[model samples]
Every structure is written in structure tokens, then in C-alpha cells.
Target: MKKFLLSILMGCSLLEAAAQTAFTVNHGPYLQEVTQDGATIVFTTSRKAFSWVELKQHDAPEAEAVKHFNSKDGLKEAWNTFSLVRVEHLKPGTSYDYRIISKEMRSFQPYKVVYGDSIATKWHTFSTIDPQKRGGSFFITSDMHFDAAKLEKLLHAADYRTCDAFFYAGDMTSYIDKFEIPFTSFIDTSVKLFASSVPFEVVRGNHETRGNLARTYSSYFPKKNGKIYGSCLLGDVMVVMLDSGEDKAENHWVYAGLNDYDAYRTEQAEWLKELMNTKEYKKAKYRIVISHFPMVMSQQWKDEKEWVGWEDAIRKFLPVLNKGNVDLLVSGHTHRYFFHEQNVDGNNFPVLEQGESSAVRLELHGGKVQFQVIGVDGKILMEKTISKK
Candidate 1:
């Protein structure tokens, strides 16, 4: 009887151990910073695990897939919940199918490692940006403020699958108090719709700078040069994304002395100066700047005192952008739509201030860029076109 009782207790312990080792994907498997020959795949796991990505050309056989792990020097990234595996050396404008694989690490020591259950996601596909290809379309939206429903509506209204890239201009959430807020507020919705296969670039907004996890933003949306502001060549267009920091001054009481945007803007300005001189920027047929705040606001807000960040942008960034021969500046912050014409309010380029209710689709073809603002009800609210610069 004693032996039988001990056997039952051991069985229960084994069952519990098995249950604890069950692994699953928590969020992401989304594409970010996708370039002509490389892309970063980010995802999180339910438990500490070693993660990797299996990738192959879309038309290739499964047996031809290559496994990629996020590693440095001689060590592979392991014992972590978040996984960021960057796949490189891909062909330009090529379609590739990929999936994430994570194995739970039950225990790890210098001489021994125990692995548990592993998980692999269904295959997803994405196409790398082709710098030489002319005429591609992209969708842009901002200030959803964590309204997943609204974001989904906008994405559907835009028919997002047909676009080469999706740009979240800023403020997808009101604030990110926890790490999960990104996945819960917007990323999860995106993965459900198109993020697993389509590369989405996030431009930082003022509100995103307000939460505790704000510093971790880059970890999720890694960019070139390790900064939020940078330029990417998508198709034939050069898209420059800028980080418009908090709306108030750095020393504002509400910030509790944590702000330093004044200097940050200066740093961006210096970077912009050099970027404009780069061969990539100068050779592009079209250029668009995505800034959360309109550096040079309309005449109506020219004297507004509440926007110190805007003032700083005008003083620091406007001059560099003007000299860069930017064709358009797309921004969202005021929740009101306004199209400022070129040479208006000290801006050499046209500025499109997209409202919260609409998504802007910019199509480049026939030497012109056509802009259509689609509303939540799936109706076109505004349309405009600009010739190549």
C-alpha cells in the first residue's frame, strides 16, 4: 500500500512538470526594419526559451529552408522570453516564407541543458523592399490611441495587403505602462491582420514617450543607427521618419525632469544634415518625411505657446528638411486634417496633417504621388496628387 501511494504521488509530480514546460507564442512574429536584403523578426514566448527562424524563398521547397538564430560572437541568444532574429543576405524584392521556432529551456547549467516542448508557427510570407523598383503604394495612419477596432477598420478600408509597407505615424497607444501594452493595444491586432507578413514601421509620437516602458520602444522596433529617426528607401521613394518628442518643454513640471527633447532634436538635425547629402537620398525620385508633429504648423497655430516641441523642430529640423528638397511631410497630432501647401508658413514642402478618423494611402506611379484619405466608413474623404520633385 505504501509503494502504491508513492507511485501515485510521483505520477502527479511528473504531470505537473509536463504542464509547466508547455510552450507557446505570446505575441508578434511580426516583421520590422525590412530592407532590400534583410528583415528583423520579433516575437515573445510564454517561457524562457531559445528561438530561431526558418526561412526560404516563397517558391522553394520546405527542405531548402535555412534556420537563423539571433546570436553574437560564439553565443546564441537563449533563456529569454523575447526573441529578435534578424535574417540577412536575402535577394531584393524577393518573396520569402518564414516561421518562428522556440524550444522551452527546462534547465541550463555549464555542462548540461534540458529542453522541453517546442513550438513552431504557421508559415508567413513577406517581400523585401526593392530600391530599384519604381512606383509602390503604402498606407499611413496615426493617433489610434489604442483603439484596436478603429485600427482594424482603417487597415481593412485601405486594403492593406496590396501595399508594400504600412507606416504607423505615431501614438498607437495613449501610454505604455507595461510591456504588454504594445501587443495588447496595437501589435496583436496587426499580427492578426497583416504584420506577420507585412513590414510595418513605427514613428514615435509624443504620447509614446510618456510611459514607463517608453525606453524599451527601440527593443521592439529596432531601426538603423539605433535611433528612432532614420531614412529608408522603399521602392523608389525615400521615406524619412522623425521622432517628434513630447509636446512640452523638457523642463515642464509634468515630465518630472526626465525630458531632454531639446537636445535630442538638435542631434536629429545634425543627422538629417548628413543624411540629405547621402547618395541614397539625393538619387531617390521622391522623398517624404513622416514626423508626428508638423514642424512648421499652419498659420493658425503659428503663435501657439503650448507646443514647445514644435517650436524646437522648426528651429532645428525645418531648415535641414527644406534643404533636402522634401516633396511632402505627413504628420498626425492635432486630430484635425489640414493640407499645407508648399512655401506656406516657412515650409518648402507640402504638409499633410492626417486626422484620427482616416488612413492615408499614397500611391506612386506615372511620375506623381496620389494621396487618398479613406474614412472609417470606407469612404474617401480627400484626394490630392503631387508631381515628382
Candidate 2:
């Protein structure tokens, strides 16, 4: 760690201090909105390191490091940057001091991040956002698309630090084909600010569905979901993160293979089946489902070229959710915010549509839950309650 820190110091030293940018240590953490369960941490890649040595958090410049993801897969993408770090099983409702530490730098021949010196990065501390309202409240929002100004405005307006955790429904960027400059930078710079005081959670939006999206997703926010579908228990709420396949014409309309997308969804569905049956889930005060696309009624997709056949699979998945008595299904794909109260084949669930810069909160009561949508200005756009008990 000593050598790593010094290497980064030397690299930054090589550059004129006059031109060096002063890094706001807790400034921006996630390029995308940050997500946390108070115990598990998740975020996007925050730095551009070519070598593993520079990959180490102790190796990057303070101006360039908070927490970052380094991945070889990123090599083909924007500037070949990848690697998202996940520190898991952290103490709940506790504050911890963390110094960014990459796995290790393995190479430096062609793209020597630092000439000969190692990168010893700086250290900073952050308190884990308390899941329970004791520390503070939490917010839910998504679909920013690297709109730095809007994100910044949202954060500023929300005063993110006041919340214990934030949940992103999905769509952090406009596209994931290649990393865009400020988009990644937005996650790099802006997200940290949001997470530093309050942690956040994420669901993969359609925008993040391009090119090795899973690899990218796992790199930064590595956590075990036990299966493809994952769940996180935060305070009194249980968040189910679903890998809801794709909703494109080729995948949705045209005959789509029931097998191709099965790998991701099958695991998730099985996990959901068992999870919904668990005693903890059954008794939980609040339960919410998050996915990139919405699951409407029993839409049959019994065909090829049309992925609607896969719709059958989703129907199979819903029975479990219905039995579980889920309170809300949060999704973002249409890009427009709309809410609907529907009984999915007799199963009642509220669909909360995510819009860019929109925030939603779930307030729990003894026997029911209320949903309130907050605009970027912290004003409530809509409010509704469910007496599902």
C-alpha cells in the first residue's frame, strides 16, 4: 500500500501542480446514481487507469480517486477503462474510513499509467447511510442519462446528504456502447457526492443493456444475489432487483428465443420463487420490485422472431410475486413517468414509472405502504397508498 500510494503521488507530481486538478475526495462517487443496502456497496467505474498498479485506489491521484472500477473489458470501450470495486458485508449503521485500493497493477508497457513510481492514493472517510430512518430518510430515482447539469441540480435540490440511502430505478446513461466523456465523469464526480453522505442502489435500465452490460454491471457493484435475480434487505424494506431481459422489437415483438434470455431470467425467477416464500419476506413491512422494463398483464409471446413468447416466462414469474404480495413494481423504460394501479391476473401491484430527475419515496405504516413521487425540486408530484395487508 505504501509503494502504491507513492507511485500515484509520483505520477501526479510529474504533471505540473499548476495544472493539476484538486480532487474533491467525496465529491462524485458514482457516474450513475449510487446504490447501497447499508451493508453492500455498488457504483460505477470512477477512474481511467490503464495498468493495474494505477488501478489500486492507493495508486490513483486524490483528484482522480474516490472509488473506481477497473476492467480489461473496458479496454475495448471508452479509453479502455473498467473495474468497479465492491466492499461487502460492511457494518450496518456505522461509519468507516476507506482508502481506495485496487486489486493490483499487473502491467505498464504500452500504457504506463505511472512511469516507474507506484500510485499511493489518498484516503478519506464516509459514514454508511443508515437504512432505518434514525440517521435519515432515503430517496428513489433513476434515468439520468449522464445529464450532469440535471443530476447536479437534482442532488442539489434533494440535498442528497439528508437521506440515508438512494435508489435508482435505472438508465444512468444515454448509451452503453462506449463510455462517453462527461457521462462517466458524471458518475465519477457527481455520484460520490451523493453517496458520500448517503448510499444508493441501482437497477439496470435499457440504456445500460448494450455491449457486455453484465460484465460492466458486476465489475463495479459486485454482490451475490444467490441467483440471477437478487434481493437486498434495507431497513424494513426488501428490494428485489430483477434481470428482466430486453424489451426491444427484435426481443419483444419479433419471435424471440425462449432459451437465449433464459440464463439471466431463469436464475432470477428461481431465486424469486424461494425468496417470496421466505418468512422474512412474507412478514416484511414493505417489498418492492425493480427492473429496467415493466411487466404488464399476461402478455403471451408464444412465437419466434417475436420475443413476446418470453412474455409467458414473465407470467410464470409473476405468480411468485403475486403470492409474495409485492407492494410496488418500479421500472424505467418508456422514458416517461406514469403510474398505474393494476391487478396482474388477480395479483394487485402498483407500477411506479421512473422519469429523469424524478424521486419517489415509500412511507410505511402498520398495515400498508404509501408511495409519493418527488420531482427534482423536492416537491411531491403524486402520492398514493396501498392497503395490501
Top candidate by lDDT = 1
Q: Summing lDDT over every window of 10 consecutive residues in candidate 1, give the lowest-scoring window.
A: 295-304
Q: Highest TM-score among the candidates is held by which one? A: 1
lDDT of 2 by residue, 274-358 (tens): 8888876775667878876666532332333354423644565666777777878877665657776766345467677766667
Candidate 1: Cα lDDT at 181: 82
lDDT of each: 0.88, 0.54
Q: How far in Å is the alpha carbon of 272 misplaced in model 1?
A: 0.8
lDDT, candidate 1, 170-286, per-residue tens = 998888889888888789999998899887889989889988888888788876468878889987789999997888778889899998898898899999999998899888888
Give the Cα error of residue 126 in candidate 2, in Å: 4.1
Give the TM-score (vs. native) of candidate 1: 0.92
Error of 2 at 199 (Å): 2.9
